[model samples]
Target: MSEALQILQKYWKHDRFRPLQQEIIDSVLSGQDTFALMPTGGGKSICFQIPAMVNKGICLVISPLIALMKDQVANLQKRDIKAIALTGGIKSNEMIDLLDNCQFGNYKFLYLSPERLQSDWILDRIKNLPINLIAIDEAHCVSQWGHDFRPAYLKISGLKDHFPNVPFLALTATATPKAKEEIITELGLHNPKLFQKSFARKNIAYMVFETDDKLFRIEQILKKNPQSSIIYVRNRKSCLEISTQLRYLGFKATFYHGGLSSKEKDKNMLLWMQDEVQVIVATNAFGMGIDKSNVKTVIHIQLPENLENYYQEAGRSGRNGDKAFAVLLTNPSDIAQTENQFINILPDKAFLNSIYIKLCNYFQIAYGEGINEQFSFNLNAFCLKYKFPVLKTYNAMQFLDRQGVITLSQEFSEKITLQFIIPSKEVIRYTSLNPHDEEILLAILRTYPGIYEMQTAFNLPLIAKKSNHPETQIYAVLQKLKEKGIIDYHSRNNDSTLIFNEIREDERTINRVAKYLENQNTLKKEQFKSVLKYIKEDKVCKSKLILNYFGEKTTEDCGICSYCITKKNKKTNTIPLSKEILLIITNEELNSREIQNRINNKSDDVIFAIQQLLENEKIILKPNNKYILKL
Candidate 1:
């Protein structure tokens, strides 16, 4: 066995690689820069991981999502592999320690966000490390034509200049031909080998239903296929509402979104993963690193902004190669809503400038100051204070982040830990004086150890369960304890981190990037139109349409998709008419109207069968407008 194969077996316990995985790995091992285009759930990670294990030095992975990076690092550590992810919001000292570990602690994999590359300190330190290969995940984001474009990715090509000999590997689940070319050109990949897996999933039955009663349709689908499923919504409110509705209908369902605390998210995800919940209704924030193979369905309740997002999300189903369904539920209003929500309301240059200036002022950063400073920003507070629309403001922040003006690290549900500030005797005395808080304090002390000496992870739900108190009541008690100086407590909440990449610039600076914003708006409008087209058009095969959109051509129809099935039903329903037409044409000559009147089928069916019979020579059309059977 090859060394890579042996390592894969040892760690991943896989005997073989999925299609195109080993080929891509071989390309990487040959020290050739390679670009891999594999669909979602195609095991793209193993391609780089196995090669990194077989090589001598660490593999540096640049990814876009902090959650994905953290999940991969945790998984690798479980297998006794040394991997570390340096995401945003890390203290400088912690970052120094992490880099030190990567350089000297035998760490084989280092994952960091693309924005981290902008730091001269980080890049300088990375140059000193014994780097074997550079891997870029979500490589399509580097292209202007791609669905999710990030300007930080354009800086990735600089790594080549620093690491002159190291090969690079770029991986993405969805990319068009233009995006593919741009990825190669922008990343400066040297004569790269390209490996593309077919964008077709035969096991997935792509379906789109236009209905006013989506809830009824969803219930019917769940009743028919009571298996593991994910229902994607557009926002947090819908996620919770849909999940609640599913539960009321007797389904074991859970909800997930960015608004949930980290502990709550983990608990809900664990329940769904363990089959305790049949469905997970969530926003797009869920499912980045989810590896559930038996997810039999992925239903989109709202129209996605583009085909790329839809394909990636729907491809999460049927990973185990079993029959699964990717059902998109939409009404007429959803089409218009999607267009207006995504394309029509894009922040213009002036609005973006206003947001930028407000953001700087919010942080009390003087103009031409605050470069590289990180702050915990409350987005709701900022929006409320400025009377700005929440969604538009958030989109503007994303636009600014894309333009490399600032980096926004979204709220992570990382658990909070706390330690007591006073002695145990002091705590007992205080609790005795306040008997109302005694039960909670005693429960905390009994349920968690090292609370006095170390900052232990505070599990509110678990503590509530143990203390036989409602979670809200427990939270109140914890706050009371914190106020009384009995014990330190940290509550989990959603708070985003903002890192200023450059000094605050004048409004004129915004004009410099106005063209870029306009171009992006145009691209977004085009993408939204494509999505609308996908939803409104019913004649084309869904799978075929998606494949073509992704730059793959296919003449054959997936016989199992919604359109193919409808066509099959139409063909089946006409079979009886063909039989009846032959029966009527035995030896007697008859005209078309006579045959149509005699046959009990629809007139159209009779005409179609007559055309079929004449084409097959089973009957002949006479000059007198009569049909007769041939010997």
Candidate 2:
């Protein structure tokens, strides 16, 4: 048994390995750059983790998502493995301490977001550590051609020079052959071992429903399945509204989106995880590291921007090796909405330039002024004040973030309400005459967390939500407490965005780059339509069609697909065309339908004959489905 197999057995308690896992692990163990294109549930993590565990040094993992990093670190720790996360939430002093521990501690894994690569301290100190492998999760992000390209990913290839001997391992759940090639080139892999798994998942049944009434369809889907499922919408408002509707339908539903307060998000997530909630209506923000094993269904209320995202998101269900359903519900009008979204997106170069200029102005710095300054920004307000479209501004900021010009941290922020914990000093002396008012002050302190940490004004809604006391009563108590000077009570709320670390302005405007980017966006719109074509196509086996997309040749259609299902229902008794049967025909060549007419069978029966004859090179097929016998 190999070290990886042994580790898998010892840690994961699995007696046998799955199909492609061992091959992938062997490639990694050989100390070569490895690209593993396993399907979503194909144990992509263990391939790297086992090698990391048995290897001589720490495996540095660069992930695009903060939540995914945190989840992986937590899971590793649960397995008695030492791991650390270099993320934004940590204070500078805390980061220093964590880095020190990573350098000296027995930590086997250190997960950092790609954006963190620009940190001077991280870059300066990493060369000193005994790093054996650099695992790039979501490796497709390195390619502009990929659906989810990140500018930060392009910078990661630079690490090869700093650690010349460290092997690079890039892993992703979905990638086309083009994406695969780009990942390899961008990572600077020298003759890397590529492990490409079949994109087929037998247990998942793909069904698409065209519907004009989305809410009715959702309600109907829920009424039928009622199992734990995820309802994915395109935006934040939909998440809240759909979840609320599910609740009204008397279903236990919760919602998740980037817009929610951190506390509410966490609480709601916990509720769903513990099965306190049976359904979660959410935006794409919901399911990166969600490890629920038995999600019986995953329904997409809206079409994703691309197939890669849809595959990854839908693949989240039926992980327990149980049969599950993945459905896409779309109305014809959605095409207009999607088209509008694509057209409204900012040109990448233009957006980046705007960000550079705005950051320069906001920080009171000259064009080249920003070097290492890090400051929080309100993206919406900034865009509004600058008269820029918010959606375009947000995408630009994201592009800038990917370009290493900024770091956008997805954080959980909450609104908090506080009632005065105590009366004013002058009133406290007077209130000391009566204990009832003093009890109110004590109750106020008990109600709110971290209220004294800041002196910012708070909102009344927050107080109403938190105090379990009426808003009017809380306000009265706050006024009395203010009068007595016992404590300051107020409401506070916070929103988060990516903070850029760039020169306030750039002398070199990349307008040419923006034009090129605009062209690419136009190309992506066409590509997105291709994805739609693939999903809506009902004539080919799902697996074979996907395989064909990646340049795989498999003549055998998967007997279990939407195409196969339709064929089966036709119940045409198809017979294979043997050489003996073909020789009986008088003509040297024949159209397949004409041949079928001679055979006195349905056109469906002719398909098998056509496929077999073509495969055997006994005949040539013309563009119009006519066939000619080989000499």
Candidate 3:
């Protein structure tokens, strides 16, 4: 216990542990398999880190995201703690060097992706290391029932063969009852001590408002809170539009979305984190690995596809225990819109089968081959070539990825590989004859050391800079050389990469997973139904509804939610709806929709209040369609 505490303070500078963190750590230290379900900001990393730090040998950490693994490794390195992550796209010699470092560098942590476990050579090297503990981050990925299911995570249990005596720790921020059971069974945890913190964030008042104008309601919420806030939309266009509108409305605002470059994301994120921007409008891509404790509000202008995602994103606020708000804004149109966006576009089983066969043929995979083969993919081009619906086909691909038929990465990048197929002396003779290509060939040879011996990844811009030519001309020269068989060259501007983990059985492969694919489509429909039910059942407490969804039954209603407040106000005969409308139009006039937008309550309630005011002669409707106080 003392050692754990000392390590925590030394590396993390934390005086004590959060709730359930220490208990989970103690179980791990006692050589017990441990599973923990904590919230997003609950410090799940420290649970594995402290116990692993207390142990003698290295702790092997398995996670899903390459970016997150690199982020953690960098953070550990900053604190002078020894850690390394075997992330993707490394050369063979680099992999060997990294593995050798893990063997003899006294590194306390070794992080890797679950897909990396499929390689026998890497696993063999890992088996030789003196690993004391195995920690799986985002452990929910192992279960099919989990929201972000990854089939590769199912392979993690195979590690038990290499380290029979070592304990394992599995950590996740969100999981359902079925997911929890499957995660335990899938990981083969031996009588694991389970710890689950309550999903309810008492300080966060979950509220939903059906309004006609979402933008105006955003203004009202921000004006009331007037602190750091996040508004989550569903698309890049909305991100830019909303952020622009907010800035026009006199707020320090920024935007983030998937389309933004890495530099843009970092700059915008820094602005918000440093309080230079008080609000950021973004899509779902902005919040991962963010732990801004004092975020006063998280507003979802679009309906969340599922409660699991909703709960995780909404829980980002009020991490410091101050009062906060989780606001979901929806109109009647949003229900059908959400359904069309998420549910209707889901691919059926037949579509899935067709898509699978097309993908195999597209990649030119032979029957019973192509295991672990990867290709730079362009989704739009593939869909166009096959005459498939882009959204439905993309959804089908996601299903295949989760089912482990293929691993998909949607990172927009350009890949260019080159190697000299002919002898270097022959290439030199040709370059001397063609004076225009001589400088480019010399630049490639000088800048890239071993292109002749290996298929080297190179940048066209760098070669152009070295040769003092335009990038297009450099590419043209390379293409001409490839035409003459001087080099083997390949380049692509790709939207994604597809890596197959199975042989190309075509129909047989699709038949194997067909039932599960249908079941997944059914499951998605049920999830969307649950989300709609949550939205319509406004009479129930928001917090209690969320708790019940996760199978956590709580009898008490959280008094901060919209239902509770409305109930309390009904008993007092003063719903504040009329009061707010009157106050806003007292000095300046606003129409019915504008009044409803100004007040973050039910439009029905707002309309009823406006009617009562009209009947009482307290307010008058002008012929111009505006409401005004009758002085």
Relative to the unseen true structure, what is the Cα RMSD of model 3? 12.1
Cα lDDT tens digits for candidate 2, 1-631? 7777788888888887888878877787788888998877777888789889888889999998787888899889998989999877677789888888989997899899887787778888777888988999988788777777776787788999998878899998887877788899988988898888887767777766554456766776677777788989987657766887778888899888876667978898898888888888888888887778888788897777877777778888888888777778765566777766655574566466766677668767666566666666655446645767767766666656665666666542333333344434544575578665555444544553445543323444444544455657766876776676656554444656445465544736454245436645765786678667866776777667666665577888766554676567456432344554466543655654446556754433454555545557876655443566666
Q: Cα deviation in Å at residue 586, candidate 1? A: 43
The runs of at least 3 residues in candidate 2 whose Cα sits more than 4 Å from the true structure, single-residue gaps closed, are 89-93, 261-263, 411-492, 507-516, 519-523, 535-538, 541-545, 550-631
Q: Worst 10-residue stretch by lDDT in candidate 1?
A: 409-418
Give the Å shift of residue 557 in candidate 1.
1.1
Which run of 10 residues does model 3 get worst, by summed lDDT? 566-575
Cα-based lDDT at residue 395, candidate 3: 87
Query: Which lDDT value does model 1 have at 495?
Result: 67
Q: Candidate 3, which segments miss by more than 4 Å at Cα?
A: 412-494, 572-593, 596-631
How does candidate 3 score on lDDT? 0.85
Q: Each model's C-alpha lDDT?
A: 0.85, 0.71, 0.85
- Highest TM-score: give the candidate number: 3
Backbone clashes, candidate 2: 16
- Arrange candidates, best lDDT first: 3, 1, 2
Q: What's the lDDT for residue 519 in model 2?
A: 49
* Cα error, candidate 3, residue 364 (Å): 3.4
